[model samples]
Target chain A: MIALLMRDLRLAMRAGGGFGLGLAFFLIVVTLVPFGVGPETGLLARIAPGILWLGALLACLLSLDRILALDWEDGSLDLLATSPLPLEGIVTMKALAHWITTGLPLVIASPLFAVLMSLPGAGYAPLVLSLLLGTPALSVIGTFGAALTVGIKRGGLLLSLLVLPLYVPTLIFGAEMARRGAEGADTTTPMLMLAGISAGVIALLPFASAAVLRVNLR
Target chain B: MELEVSELSVARGGIPVLEGLNFRLAAGHALILRGPNGIGKTTVLRTIAGLQPPLAGRISLDRETMTYAAHADGLKATLTVEENLSFWAAVFGTGGIDAALDGFALRDLRARPAGALSAGQKRRLGLARLLVTGRPVWVLDEPTVSLDVEAVAMFVRAVRAHLAGGGMALMATHIDLGLDEAAVLDVGPFRARAAQEDHFDEVFL
Candidate 1:
């Protein structure tokens, strides 16, 4: 398992690795928001939580197709299925790698991007905290979607349709927690909910993704 | 070790493509499956490799004893040849890739990214992966698609060596691989009847 994860990480760091694309997209989206909505600090701060959440969500979506498509295309998926490692374990590791490559970067970069939106003082911590908690769920859900569409030609568009709906609860609770934190209101409920979603997804979705991957590989 | 497939049936897109197939491969043996294109050769190899469930029948082998090589070589374009071999070696709990690299004559290309290799070299890399698998049974689908005459000879020699060491191989290909004493099973007879009813309900569910 460690070997597989390390290989994926190494692959992501090489040329055309896709390591920085998600971060670049996140940066672009955040930077462009103020111009579109006007440079007013109050307005940027008011909608900052939603805008940041939406940008992270889209950034996550942009990379979902890559999780399984490369392996599937090159026939690594077939060899992986027949290996001693179980499909469920493989799915889990792929999700973890996706988190490492895409989700972790987005989390680390969120605070820097949040400043562009004039995020309130309290919002910074919550934004980072919520993302740190929420992005795992995003990666897991996206893995399931990627597995489902890995066999289809040009599955990028369909992947968004499948994964975006599942991102709702995480986005809602994450954004809500950040908003409440910025407003100096109670954030415990939304924070807990966000964590709960992440936990449930991390626990149960590998089986679903493995099952889908088996069918697709067939 | 023995691989026994009894009355195996396989389908593509819910329609049975190959039906009522039977074969047995003992240790130190090789079986070559031959047929025209779209004749379900790949499907049969996949079924024996346990990638998908047979529509109806039994495929018996020791668990985790088989390694499959598909048409695509499964090489990562950005990684060097050694990196590619070592990753599979680690995944299968094998010790080193020295034998695989030497077997495929990939020692010189070890430092080169896989994308830089020619088609034949890539296929050689793909075929080399089976050696590091440390599995007894090799289920290869058209393992020699883009090989030159020399590379094909290298693959034949590799199979012969594996068989001499009690390893078994089941390959589906159109070209002759020059393996004496290997049994040939023409899949043409096993093609599924076209008039069979569709299993639409089961497929969707």
Candidate 2:
């Protein structure tokens, strides 16, 4: 399992761009938002929680296909399937790798993007916390989507379509938590909900991903 | 240990491709599957390797007892030759890649990324992965596609060494590998019946 995760990290790093490209896309999207939404600081701050949440979600989505598509293309997935490791282990390691590569960076960078939207000071911790919890769910769910469409050629658009609806719960709870935090309101409910969703997803979604990968390999 | 397949059936894209196939590969031996392109030789090898479920019958060998190498090399282009070997080595719970590196004569290219190697060199690296698997049964599909004469000799020698070390190999290839220890199984006769017969099976499913 560690070997698979290390290999994935090495591949992402060597593939050039790695998480940097995703971060750049997030930056561009957030930077463009204030321009498009008019330079009203109040309005920007008002929408900042959702914008940052959406930006982080999209950034994580950017590389979900790479989690499995590259392995599927090179036949590594087949070889891995035949190895002593179970497919569930492989899927878990893949999602973990995706989180470390894409989600971790997005979490770390959200505060920087938060400032761009003039988000209130109190929201920073909750924004970061919500994303830290929410992003793992995204990676896990996205792994299932990636596994589902791995065999189809140019399935990136399909991957996003499959994963977006699933992201709604995470995005809503995370953005709501951040929004309430920005407003100096209580954030306990949304925070717990986001954390619950992530916990449930982390514990179970890999099975679905592995099962789907089995069918794809078949 | 030996691999035994009896009355095994496999398919491609939901259509039965091969049926009632039977073959046994014992320790210290090799079996070569012979059939024309699209004759379902690959399907049989995959089924035996446990990559997919068979439609019927059984393979007596445990899946853990084997390693499979397909048409694709499964090499990471950005990883060095040594890095690539070690990755599989670790994944397969093997100790070192020195033997695989020596077996494929990849020492000279050890530091070079796999993407930098020529086609034949890449193919050699791909084939070398089998050495690190540490499994007795080698399930291979067209193991020598882009090899030159010398590389082909290297592969043949590798197979011989594997068999001598009490390993077994099952491969689907058209070449005359000149291995006297290997008995060939021609899959032409096992090809599934025409469309009409398959429709009956499909309806049953």
Candidate 3:
């Protein structure tokens, strides 16, 4: 499993364009929001957390179809299914790799990017922490969408459509807490719920992804 | 050692492709599955490999079950050829990496990504994965599909060698695999749910 994770991480990094594209997309969304909203400093600071959360969610969705789609296209997924390692383990490893490449970098870069919209200093830690806990769930849940769409030739738009609805609860909870923290309000309730969602996904999503992959591959 | 399939049936897109097929192979023997496209030769192999469940049947091998290799080759293209084999070898916990590589004659291409291999070479690489598995039963679909004449001969040699070493093979192929005493199971005329007594194992002649 360590080997599979290492392998996917290397692939994501070496792909040269996919990683940069995702990061750039995240940055562009964050950078472009201020322009649309008139560059008003007070308004920017007020909506900073929501903007970051929304941008992160969109950026994560942009890359979800690519997750299993490439592997399926090139026949690596078939090898994965036949490997003695259960499919669930393969899904987890792939999801972890996705998180490390796309989600972790977004979490790390959020604070720097947050400043683009005049995010206050008080909100930085919780914004980063909430993303840290929540993005893995995004990656995990996205695996199911990827699996279902693995056999579909033109599946990119369909994948976003399928996955976005499932992501609503995570988005609501994550953005709400980040919004509270940015406003200097108590955020314990929403943050805990956000963490719970991540935990539940981490526990259950791999098996579901594997089951779907089997059916699709069959 | 014997691998048995009893009353195996499968459907594709709601149509029955293979219905209640039964066959068995003992150690040191080979069964050539012959059928046309749209038939269920590949389906039988997949079902035995545990990838697809039989609609109604059981597959047991030498007091145990078996593993399968479908046409897809099941490789991670981003990884080096060696990494692909090593990952599976580690999973099966069988031969060491060095031995598996040497056995497949893949030492030179260890650093080459699987994506770089040609179709014939990819087929060999796929077969190499099965070799590294060290499993008792080999369920191969179109094992020689992408190979050249030389590679096909090499595959024949490998299977003959594997059988001599007590491993069992259930292979689906349209071409003759050059087995001296191998039995052929004509899955074409044979319906999916034939009785065990109805099975006839005839040499290729």
Candidate 4:
């Protein structure tokens, strides 16, 4: 599992764009929203939570294609499938790699994203926390979409079509928690649900990803 | 030890490909699967390697499970040649694939990314993955598709060495692999029949 994770990290790094590209794309989206919404700081702050969540989701979507497509193209996916290691382990490791390259950076850079929207100091912690709990689910669930579409030619648009609907619950709750936190309200309920969603995906999505990959390869 | 498949059947995309197929291979034994393209040669390898579910039958590799290598080379293009070998080596619980790489004359290319390698070089890399796995049974599909003659000889030499070391190989190849009197299993002979009538021409022929 460690070896697979390292290999993924190496690939992302070698690809020369995953980490920075996601972060920059996310930053651009967050930065551009304020311009479009008018330079009203108060308005930006109110919409900040939604903008940030939306940016995160879009950033994740941008890079999801690379998740399985690279391996499928280069033949690594086939090797990993046939390895003695369980498919579940392989899937978990892949999600972890995706998180490190895209999710972790987006989460880490959220404060800058928060500032761009003129978000208050209070909402910053919860914004980060919600992402920490929610993005794993995004990565895991996105992998299933990647697996399902890995065999299709011109699969990128189709992949988003398959995955974005499933992403709604996470995005809604994550953005809501940030909204409540910004208003100095308790966010425990939505935050816990977000955490639960992440845990569930981490545990169960691997089997689904594995099954879909086997189907796609066939 | 022998890898045995009794009454094996496989289906793909909702259609039956092979049915009631039977074969066996012991250490130092090689079985060549001969068939027309798209006739399930690759599917048969996938079944024995445990990548695909067999619709019916059992596959026992040395009375254990087996390993499979496909024509796609199963390599990460981003990783160096050595990293690819080491990854599979670690998975298959083998060591010293440096010798296998060196034997294939891939020593200098060890640090090169797989994407930079030519077609034949990539195929050699794929074969090297199987070698590094060092499993008791090998299920290979089109093991020599992109090789030049020299690389082909290198592959033949590698297979010979593996068989000599008490390993069993099941290879699906169109061209002759030049193995010494391998026990060939012509999968073309075992066609599935909708009714008994489909077998009339086959039986009479």
Candidate 5:
């Protein structure tokens, strides 16, 4: 499993692997928000949490296809399936690699993007915290979606359609948690809920992803 | 150990392609599959390799007992030839790749990225992967495609070495791999009838 994870990270770091693509997209989207909503700091501050969460979520989604598409195309997936490793472990490692390459960088960069949207000073901690907890769930769920659509030709649009609905619960809890922190309200409920969703999906989604991958390989 | 398949059936996209196929491959031996294009040769190899579920019958080997290679080469363009082999070696915990590199004549090109290699060179690298897998059985499909005479010779040598080492191989190819000891199984006799509706899911169409 570590070999797979290491290979993915190395591939991402290589040319045309799109390692930085998600981070760049996140930056562009967040930078454009202030321009679209005008210079009113209050409006920017109010919408900042949702916009940042959405931008990060979409950015994570942007690169999810890479999780398995290249491997599937080159038949690395078929070879991997026949290896001694279990498919469930393979999918989990893929999700872990995605979170490391895409989600972790987003979490680190969230505070800077948060500043661009004129977010409240109080919002920084909760926003970063919420993302650190919530974005992993996005990576995990996006992996399932990627696996489902791995065999389909030009399945990017369908992947987004399938995955966006699943993101709803995480988005609601995550953005609400950040919003509550911005408003200086209690964040315990949403924070715990967001963490719950992340843990839940991390625990159970790999089996589903592995199963779907088997059917596609079939 | 020996690999066995009895009354084996396989399908594609919910339609039966081959039925009543039977074959046995033992250690230190090889079996070559012969049939025309679209004759489900790939399907049979895939079924025996356990990539997909066989439609019916039984295959004696477990899924991990064999390693499969097909047209894709399963390579990453961005990684060097050595990096590629090392990655598989690590995945299978098969130890060093030096022998694979030497066997495929890839030692000199070890540092070159896989995408930089020519067609035959890339194919050589792909075949070298089989060496690192260290599995008991090798299931290959037209593995000699795109090779010049020399590369084909290299592949034939590798197969000879594999079988000599008590490993097994099941291949689908039209070319002569020149393995005199290997048995040939023609899939033409096992081709299913042309009704795409032989499967239970036909009713949904």
Candidate 6:
């Protein structure tokens, strides 16, 4: 499992792996919001949490196809399926790799991107916290989508259609937590729900993803 | 290790492609599946490899004892040859890509990225993966799609050595693999017939 994770990470770092594209898209989205919404600080601060959350989600989505498509294309997925390692473990490692390559970077760069939207001081910690707690769910859920569409040609649009619906709960709770924190309101409920969603997804989705992958490979 | 396939049936797109097939391959032997294109040669190999469920019948083998190599080479373009082989080795809980590199004559290209290799070189790398698997049985599909005569000879030598070492192989190919004693299973006779009479049976019932 560690070997698979390490190899995927190494592959992501290499050229054409789209390592920095997610971060670049995040930056571009956040930077464009102020110009489109105008430079009014109050309005920017008001929508900052939502905008940041949306940007992170889209950035994560942009790279979801990378999770398993390459392996499927190159036939590594087939060999991996027949190996001693179970498909569940391979799916888990893929989600972990995707999180490391795409989700983690979005979290790390969020604070910098948040400034462009004139995010309030309190929004920073809550934003980072919500993202840290929530992005794993994104990666996990996106992996399921990737597995489903791995066999199809031009699966990107279809992947978004499949995964974006699943992202709703995470986005609602995450954005709510950040918004409540920025407003000096209690954030316990949304925060706990966000963590619950992440924990549940992390615990359960690999089996589903693995099952889908087996069918696709067949 | 013994691979037993009894009355196996396989389908593509919900329609049966091959049916009522039976074969048993014992240890230290090789089986070559020959047929024209689209006759389900790949299907039989895949069914034996446990990649998909047979529509009907049984395929029994020790799951951990088999490794499959499909048409695609499964090589990561960006990684070096050694990195690619070593990754599979680690995944299979085996080591010694040095032997695999030497077996495929890939020692000179060990440092080069897989994307830089020619078609034949890539196929060699793919074939070399079978060795690093360290498994008793090999299920290979079109193992020699793009190889020169010399490369083909190298593959034949590798299979002979594997068999000599008590390993078994089941390959599907159009070209002759030069395994003098390997049993051949032609899938042409096993092609699934049309379902023209199923409606009558259903109506009578």
iRMS values for every prediction:
0.8, 0.8, 3.2, 2.4, 0.9, 0.7
TM-score for candidate 5: 0.97
Recovered fraction of real interface contacts per model: 0.85, 0.76, 0.42, 0.62, 0.85, 0.84
Which regions in candidate 2 have their CA more than 4 angstroms from the true location? B195-205
Q: Which ranking of candidates, highest lDDT first? A: 5, 6, 1, 2, 4, 3
Error of 1 at B86 (Å): 0.5
lDDT of 2 by residue, A1-218 (tens): 89998998888888662757678889999999998999899999999999999998898888888889888898888999999999999999999998998888889999999989999998999899998989999999999999999989999999999999999999999999999999989999999999999999999999998898988998
TM-score of each: 0.96, 0.97, 0.90, 0.93, 0.97, 0.96
True contacts kept of 4: 0.62
DockQ of 4: 0.51
Candidate 3's error at B205, in angstroms? Answer: 36
For model 5 chain B, the run of ten residues with the poorest summed lDDT? B193-202
Predicted structure 2, TM vs. truth:
0.97
For model 6, residues A129-175, the per-residue Cα lDDT tens digits are 99999999999999999999998898999999999999999999999
Tell me how many clashing residue pairs each candidate has.
Answer: 0, 0, 4, 0, 0, 0
Which residue pairs overlap in candidate 2's backbone?
none
What would the per-residue lDDT of candidate 3 be over residues B1-205, giving only the tens digit for each residue? 7988888787655456677678889998999999877578877776676667778877775323355777778776667888888877776777677755655577899999887888877788888887777877788888888788887777777788788989888888888767767789888765544322333333332
lDDT of 6 by residue, B54-124 (tens): 89999989989999999998999999999999999999889789889998899999999999999999999
What local lDDT score does residue A58 receive in model 1, on the 0 to 100 scale? 89
- lDDT per residue as tens, model 5, A75-171: 8999999898999999999999999999999999999999999999999999999999999999999999999999898899999999999999999
lDDT of 3 by residue, A13-111 (tens): 664427756678989999999889988999999988888998998988888887888878766676667666788998888888888888999999999
Q: What is the lDDT of residue A75 in candidate 1?
A: 88
What TM-score number comes out for model 4?
Answer: 0.93
**Candidate 2, position B142, lDDT:** 95
Candidate-wise lDDT, in order? 0.91, 0.91, 0.81, 0.84, 0.93, 0.92
Instruction: Kindly report which residue stretches of model 1 are placed more than 4 angstroms away from their true locations once superposed.
Output: B195-205
Q: Which residue ranges in model 5 land beyond 4 Å of their true spot?
A: B194-205
TM-score pick, better of 2 and 3: 2
